[model samples]
Target chain A: MVETKVSKSQTKSTSQLEKPPSLMRGLMLSKITSWVLFILLSVLAVVQLLPLVWLFFFSLKNNQEVFNLSPLAFPTEPKWENYVTVWTQGNINTYFFNSVWITAASVLLTVFVASFVTFAITRMKWKWNKLVLGLFMVAMMIPIHSTLIPLFSFYTTIGIMNHPLALIITYSAFNLPITIMILLGFYYTLPREVEEAAIMDGCSVHRLFFTIILPMTKPVLATTAIINMIYNWNEYVFVNTFISSDRFKTLTVGIQNFIGQYSTDWGAIGATLMISIIPILLAFFVLSNRIVEGITSGSVKG
Target chain B: MLYDFKKKGEHEMDKVMSDKKVILLYVLPALILIMTIVYVPIILTGYYGLLKWDGIGEKTFIGLDNYSKLLTDSMFWKSTYHSFLLAAFSVISLGAYLLVSVILSGKIKGSNLFRKIYLVPMLLSSVAIAQLWMKVYHPTNGVMNRFLLSIGVENPPLWLADTSIVLYAIFLPIIWQYAGFYILIYYAALKNIPESLVEAARIDGASPWQIAYKIKVPLIAGVIKVTIVLAVVGSLKYFDLIYIMTDGGPNGASEVMASYMYKQAFRMNDFGYGSAVGFFLLLIALTVTWLIRKLTATKEEVQY
Candidate 1:
């Protein structure tokens, strides 16, 4: 199935590059080599996923089973109670909700602001546009640890030290550079005629941007939003540093503390870790293409 | 008539788009956020390093003391060494990622599925990865030791407990977590190369290895340089996994600069000293980024 597609593309490319369809050599590997490479890739795929599979298995087993049986052995009877206990007894529910809301709010804030900024820099005429863009790009290189001390001090002075607002603002700010970077490529490729026609028809800048530009950029916006979602969802340092109370903490930090109490219980620990990661894994399964596209577009232009 | 109207439209378009008020409305929300959140705090970090306050105490200006102290601090230097070691490991691993990407980008079946599968580990949070790997490295019950013991090996080298092997042990998970990411990046770059270019080379009887080495590699040199910068700088700032897995532990054998700074500030409450370390980390990151870019700058851009 794949070989025919490969040869079809190769034939078209070769015929395009060469004037005559003279005798041509195969552009792909032979059957044996292809099989060898395919096997190697499959091995890597297993290596990448084996730990998670093992975790899921152990999560269903009691201590005796986890210890006595083969690592790959299925539980004789799955202990679904591990998941139930963590959800009901531990602070997993609070952390899960906090993670969801905070991740959503940050993604929304980041994408909205980044869209405007990218639109301004790429579409709207401004003299300091390049300089401002440079500032954001340079900020991408600044280590968050460098800002942690001052940010902590600033939050303290402002009396928001233990606030979830702290995490939201920092996530949005730290993420703007990358979000804008991804949007920059898409914005640049957009035709200027749309904005020109809207202005010619007496539309205000805000009107045109809100109605036309915003909707036009939905695809790239989805990419940046997913990228932001992954980042904000997985973020640990800010949540660990700022939010003190369990109610405000996200899954990343919450799971750390949750695991501390259940240290010796492999099944409970496995459940806790799985709970922390399931949201992201679910998103990846649904939107793997956009995530790949987002990451590639985000970094390649760097 | 049509030309004049079009010219007038252009003039009207410029007026609306270039309005300063509108520009600020568009740019300031994000600009202010970054400035106050990112830029301002960075400058303040440098200032905080000069104080002697214990996070919440009255500040006493102690100019250059913290900086000078950092210069001679053995722990600071040791942590910095560990950071560079991680950077070295990360950079070395890029070669492996590139090789996998080169093969995966070939005309292989289920390449898309393989790429996505490789990316699964990367999507999980570092804390999750850290916890999972800590279990995987458990001396008695970990999958690692179990496999070793089953194969007739008596001692499996307490992976994270022994100082000599802890750093390397932690690095294995780092490789696991990021292998998909770098491979995805390289694969994307390889796929971007014009199909016609590769076909032309193939017709000239270039072997696959020769084509990959001589053609594909040089063309993607720019992406390779970017990945190098990402890996090095990312490693320098690396804290989460190590912090979770070891907390730079078993007597600080695996301590890196970021975790060390984190401990000094948050754990030890020596905010001033942590600021000093933090500021130094910033300087090192920026300098390394610039250094890599300068070193890899070609006389002429790789123009395809």
Candidate 2:
């Protein structure tokens, strides 16, 4: 794609130039400049990934080695024991499972509910459609802090404070807007023929949505699911605010306390942090394009 | 070919699709959830601001006293100042991200991989980023100090522990976390420009700089304005990294508005004052969003 775009422009410019020597020199100079730009871009990429690489390195090192050896050095005998020790001994294992289940429940619930709303707003006619859509859109900008006090108080009053249900429900509610936004773009461009054809065959509304619409939207479902999964897995504020129990806390807050207790154990701290992030990293490695597409579509159009 | 059957088909579709019962079934769940979990609490924040109550105790009718006290609170003002300071720095830093995006949008090799690499930090949780960066800034064993000492520096400054420099120190990781997000947005926008327009400019002997500034920037003005609003409003609510890295520590040098409000309500149990601060944040976010959209509202957007 880049070659075509470049060569198309090069042909246009050469046709206009009519001077061979200067034109060839110009192409050479432009190629050199592009290589320079590419090199700088490569360096920027390195800068971005260096910290994580260093984290991985030191997660395998003891405090003595980390302090005495260079910051960038590989461990002489890599300590796979660090991960095993943290995972089995500390609260890290419990937090890891909690993050996984909570993240899964929230993402599934948020995406399904959001899909329902988007289908209604885009396909079904209602008097309050625009108003309801506007409400969700506006909610996206309401600072989460503004809602924190009321949410905290409400949870305590309802006796659900410190419950994983509280985390799941809050995650689902907050993520509804962006999920709908991404789904809305795809839903709007969907051809009505498939739905119309299904309706003509006298399919029930439930069946139509489940068998036809939902199945057809697998790509977007993956997108919203991945995005929500990332958000919920990494969520700290809500879990910290509501859940105080060590057994219930997600990795984010749980790891904070873990680090607090083992303050001087760099290997343990590093390993704990790695456990917290590995799920999201794995999700990105597999579904990166969908995540990128979801983010860009969710924001740029808005 | 035929309007009658098509019209009949459309009428059937709309009639079935808009069944009030099904529509209600579908939309009502999400609407109710957001209202109870989001909207109701949004209004309740301001109402709670009028009360003087701790999280566990009985409430007393303060009647705007908390709000009034917020107006006079020095710590509140300082936190607000720090938030706005971060906002200002974020808006300024868009220039650097824009530069990177402009280059990446060119015919550069591995641009796809580069952007993805840049986005790695963004994908991680704020807690993880904070923990990693805390290690990076550890006083004696941290990567920053070690590197400085390796380069023959006699002394390295304390990072998050130094009250004077903690806020600025916190900004470094914040910058690292967000650079890729802004770059991704700008790169996507830049890619939307028609290749023919750039080709025409090149054929006309326009330097790359002139083409970029005189033509490309004007074309993507709308996106830039959107990004400006995002950066400013986002920075205003920034919390996680600072909360983890410093916990507004070293005597409150890094207390942004969100963290300050969290500490007040959650830690100090000053629920009334915290409600007031939260309400103030909502107002500023809405106002800043409106102000930027109005200010950057262009009369005529450049067409493709």
Candidate 3:
């Protein structure tokens, strides 16, 4: 009797489960919802990509075609010469080289200096390590706008106003706090026994850092390099303030001149933006995973 | 043999320490750089605030004059009020958006794809985002107005042109660009919540809302605090987008503290008043951040 009752209850529960439409029905509903979501997401993605697409399309269109035709529609004939014209007339080639040189110099300096400070703080026995860490944190909190006026004054006094190296140093210094924080996290996670063994083997502090610690921390260094590169490459405010010459203007400022007084040439403006963003996009695409990891680590902690 | 080697090593270490000064030498470059770049600028700004000088000229002492003028400056007050409003709007909207996105991120397939799509705005430079949105918000030929018109609305408001609606319009783009970041943060925190608790709640017939409120929200309080702090700080310092979009006006309606100060310093060349505005901004940011930290302090340790 008990077995019969139990079987009856089990059957009732199973029937209830199956009663809310068949399994096929449930699957169909889910499939429909998933498709709907997929379509929605795709539309959103396209919307996000529209600006870039517009830029590319405009870049290939002449100024007359751009203004005369629908802005959303493709050009009837692609003007390939516009690219050549923007490259030459815009002085983008010089700006591109300037950006590359400045970004590379800044990245190298930041990575090296930040890694050294992080290594000393994390790995070595130092009396003032805590103080240094606190200082970096405070520096990170201080807004750049507050210091810009005074910094301009100071830079002018130092006679390095338009110099690329000066900009590199300033960028590196501004970027060091976050870089050190990131590298410190990676450095602290390193196994202590390796450093101990190195010390036991009579490796000096400098040698130990250069040969052992830095090699293990290459992933983070690469991450830092990529981040600092993107920042310095695209940085507008500092570059705008510090460098005024046409020859020395970074891509950010150089592209701004495209929007001249009366009317912005949409075609030229769009083309310049596309050209300027290419290097950054390539770098981001290559180092996307590292970038994600670095940002998450820094952001979550901060 | 061991004792002899130990004695010799001790003597060598002493010699190395005495001769090399390794620690100081190693740290000197970073120290000098930080002192010059970070500390000196901060100190100098404060000192410069006391003087009256343009970018080119020498200083004249002006004791408390900038500060006194700041008290009565209608523009300064308007900018601060706008900043507060922006902060409030951002925190509330972004907080809700992040919460919804985090919940959606969990049950959805292709969540990483969604994350990457959302993160595009954050990855792009602020200038690019600003310019792109400017096109979208264009009055006659813009996509937004065109869409509104297509939807059978007879007229669409001029976004940045309308003084009343301009601040809110500007606010939307900033929110769009940054919401993804907060979504990622909240999602990370949610991922750390043990699935067992959620499953247990489900078995107990707890609804999704109940599970979220009772389990997830309380569990991820630390992350929420951090998100709020970041949002507040970011909102206060927001300038690039506004600068590029409207230059803080059709009629200074969208002016925030940062933009106002930038205009005062660079455009108006009022270094003295600009310095005052800068200090005021710094003070407000610091005070708000400190207050948030104090308010959010808890003794209960949050375990993953």
Each prediction's whole-model lDDT (CA)? 0.91, 0.89, 0.76
Model 1 alpha-carbon miss at residue B229, Å: 0.4
Where in model 2 is the C-alpha error above 4 Å?
A1-22
Question: What is the C-alpha lDDT profile of model 3 across B188-223, one tens digit per residue?
Answer: 668778887777776686655677788888888887
Q: Interface Cα RMSD per model, in Å?
A: 2.0, 2.1, 4.1
TM-scores of chain B, in order: 0.99, 0.97, 0.89
Model 1 TM-score (2 dp): 0.95
Off by over 4 Å in 3: A1-47, A63-71, B1-20
Per-residue lDDT of candidate 2, residues B1-304 (tens digit):
4898788888988899889999999998899889999999979999989998897898888899989888998988898999999999998899999889888887677888888888899999999999999989988888888889889997798999888999999998999999988898888889999988987887787888787889887888888998898899999999999899998888878998999899989999989889989999999999999999998898897799
Task: Kindly list the per-residue Cα lDDT of model 1 for residues B24-44, writing each as its tens digit.
Answer: 999999999999999998888
Task: Tell me how far the alpha carbon of residue A301 in candidate 3 is from the true structure, in angstroms, after superposition.
Answer: 2.1
Who wins the DockQ comparison? Answer: 1
Writing each residue's lDDT as its tens digit, candidate 1 over A5-31 gives 676667768656432222234433354
Candidate No. with top lDDT? 1
A1-35 in candidate 2: lDDT tens per residue? 67666765776676554222234456678778888
Comparison by DockQ, 2 against 3, better one: 2
